[model samples]
Target: MNEIRVFCPATIANISCGFDVLGVALDSVGDEMVVRKIPEKGIRITKLEGQDLPKETERNVAGVAGLTLLEASGYDGGFEIEIYKKIKAGSGIGSSAASSSGAVWAMNELLGRPFSKIDLVRFAMEGERLASAVAHADNVAPALYGGFTLVRSYDPLDVVSIPNPPELYATVIHPQIEVKTSDSRSVLRTKITLAQGIKQWGNVGGLIAGLFTNDYDLIGRSLEDHIVEPIRSILIPGFDNVKSEALNAGALGCGISGSGPSIFAFCKGETIAKKVSESMKEVYQDIGIDHDVHVSKINTNGVRAI
Candidate 1:
């Protein structure tokens, strides 16, 4: 028998304009885990904390990811998994992706570490798809590689890494509101015009280039969205106020993190990050909603064994 432990950091995917192709890891929001290998050929999750996480391996996000890893790596063994959930559910913080990444990472270690980082991301995305009904690489990439990543390609193969950026700070605000992924997806438009699509691609390209060059102005200017956010932003109260407040508070760039309710802002330093967090909180407060705010730096390492 063998034991393994892993920690998966929460992530902000899409980052507004990039939509399904960008993400970053947050140091404060995440999940923890402990695992033990068993002789049997089935999986079991014995414990889970935080609200309403499934205990049975068959029904759990981590369990699905573990199964995916086993299939990808050709391994069979029972796993007893314990989950410590730090990120809140429905926070737009990639909670499902974190669990999936953690499980796959832990299982890989227990099985002598067979899959590569991209392979782990693919497996984790598979598990997330089970939860969200879509295979998105945005969360999985940062959960596996850390820092700010551009999912340059995702399909039959996934390729990405941290882009070079000046020291950056992120502020995340999660309002205590629940919006199901299915509902969020339903609100989005399924089609886009050629002009709007081209603008989005241009912004995405600028974002990638800005990261590589540490160009804050370019990054801020490029944080434009012609799709997704416009539709879903309506679901969140005080969204416009929050965004306005963040930028007014000196965030280089700010937008909805993944979907709704939880928002993230990018700042040049801790001072602006804290200010942005406060501003975001104030917006929510004015709207009569309770919220939690975190000011954290980029987590260069996505998930780690502890």
Candidate 2:
């Protein structure tokens, strides 16, 4: 195919206790991208719509990611990327990740999949590094691997795709506020107590076990974040109320979606997911904060041709 159009799912990173390691893709919300092979020898951002963003090849996330892939592949021809941004930047829902992963994924398809998923993630990390000054893969891994992914290690670059419970659903609330990943990270403390570290490790292990064993209750209990949430929650408005109301609405668990501004809750079914959405919105509404909410199943297909 000379050109490819794809739907790149938005992802929820850090998943409470997982913190830079675990993430899942949302089926309902994301960005659309169209990639085309070009005779030119370099990447370009041909068209950008939806959000006001940089279109320059060197400045945009998609461009940076595409360029990384192009450099790695040694592909003689270049590719042009057109991004239709649905996820707002700095909303903490993997906005940069969708663009970055989508661009590289499309280019990989056009080149007949010369690189593996892991390689694509490494390429996408460049775009993330440009955006947040850190090459974290919590968002990009899920956007590429789909369902749930655990970043086991960075040195060897091992990413493990986890099996999600079939009935799992997610309700996400994005308050119309910008929370740049860099700014959010700035609020985090550099140190944690040994007790907190042990608790976090146990929760991470419990969460993975809950998913593997289909234990919804275990998942809920394990969603607690001892280290990051306390400091980061201060950045988001009505975060405590949102989490409380979501649990009351029968959500399995609720936590900040990424850094801040967006919160996500896991539910057993769509009905509870919608109920959780209402609960999330109610908090924002009472506070007179503009917001966007979405209820979605775990997207088994992360980035796909559309």
Candidate 3:
């Protein structure tokens, strides 16, 4: 069979408040998967790259995703998978999701396409389950549809593509630290007050509305998250100072991305985005931690073959 290749972009979910719900695709970073049929029966991952990546199916996130798709699609064949890892795993950068989503997408194409993007998303969650023990749709949604997305309810099977706001930039900072998703979730309070829940949902609604209308002010105003951010920020080193620096550099809004250790700051244009990125980098430098910053736009094309 001809080789099938797929690419999935990195995503930052929650954006400070919309925990487990909102996420946006980044234009410049992601991972790739290649799949092809072999005459054998079991799965064989021929190659794996990147830091701390595992090759065994039980440990390889992409391998698990491909096997899950094969089982769901009722295709019985030996498959050779090669994962080109670009996104670093465990930086709260949706690395596992990209691998899973890319594997599912590549295998679907190789099998003459059996699953829809929505169906593949559910299948991809198997990989996340292997890693994070929860079915997260944030990375999967953006990896499938591109642009901004809202996973309103995972169990109820709801996913929507949030409209892209114009003149927006996402400045991402990844510090050299590893915070597992399980640990991150454990840090969150199981029960939040009614007032806090209201505020969180209010920001969510406002973020949605702002995206639809391209209102930067509303988006900025809505980006504030008093609940999850406060609890999760403690996991990352120099989190508060970095956030303050990003905002002080003229960011429209700034907050922790997904779990922690990676911060995303939104700005109105490239100039402010660059400034915010520089400011974030400076904070990490001051803290004596190695970091990387990217001033990127929202990726509108989600995942596609290269």
lDDT: which is higher, 1 or 2?
2
- Full ranking by TM-score: 2, 3, 1
Global local distance difference test of model 1 = 0.84
Give a tens-digit lDDT track for model 3, residues 1-306. 468777778988878778888898888888877778887776788888666688998687777877888788777676888888888887777888888888888778888887888998888888888888887788888887788988878677788988877789999999989887888888888898999999989998999899999999999999899998888888899999998998889998998888867999989989999989999999889889999888888888887888
Report, for every candidate in turn, its global Cα lDDT versus the true structure: 0.84, 0.93, 0.85
Better of 2 and 3 by lDDT: 2
Off by over 4 Å in 3: none
TM-score of decoy 1: 0.95
| Deviation (Å) of 263 in candidate 2 | 0.5
List pairs with backbone clashes in candidate 1.
Answer: none
Error at 270, model 3, angstroms: 2.2
Identify the superior model by lDDT, candidate 1 or candidate 3: 3
* TM-score (all chains, Cα) for each model: 0.95, 0.99, 0.96
Ranking by lDDT: 2, 3, 1
Q: Could you list the CA RMSD of all candidates, in the order they appear?
A: 1.5, 0.8, 1.4
Model 2, range 1-306, lDDT digits (tens) per residue?
Answer: 999999999999999999989999999999999999998899989899999999998999899988999998999999988899999888888999999999999999999999999999999999999888898999999999999999999999999999989999999999997777778888888889999999999999999999999999999999999899988888898999999999999999888888978999999999999989998999999999999999999998799999
In terms of lDDT, the best-performing candidate is: 2
Off by over 4 Å in 1: none
Clashing pairs in 2: none
Lowest lDDT 10-residue stretch of candidate 1: 157-166
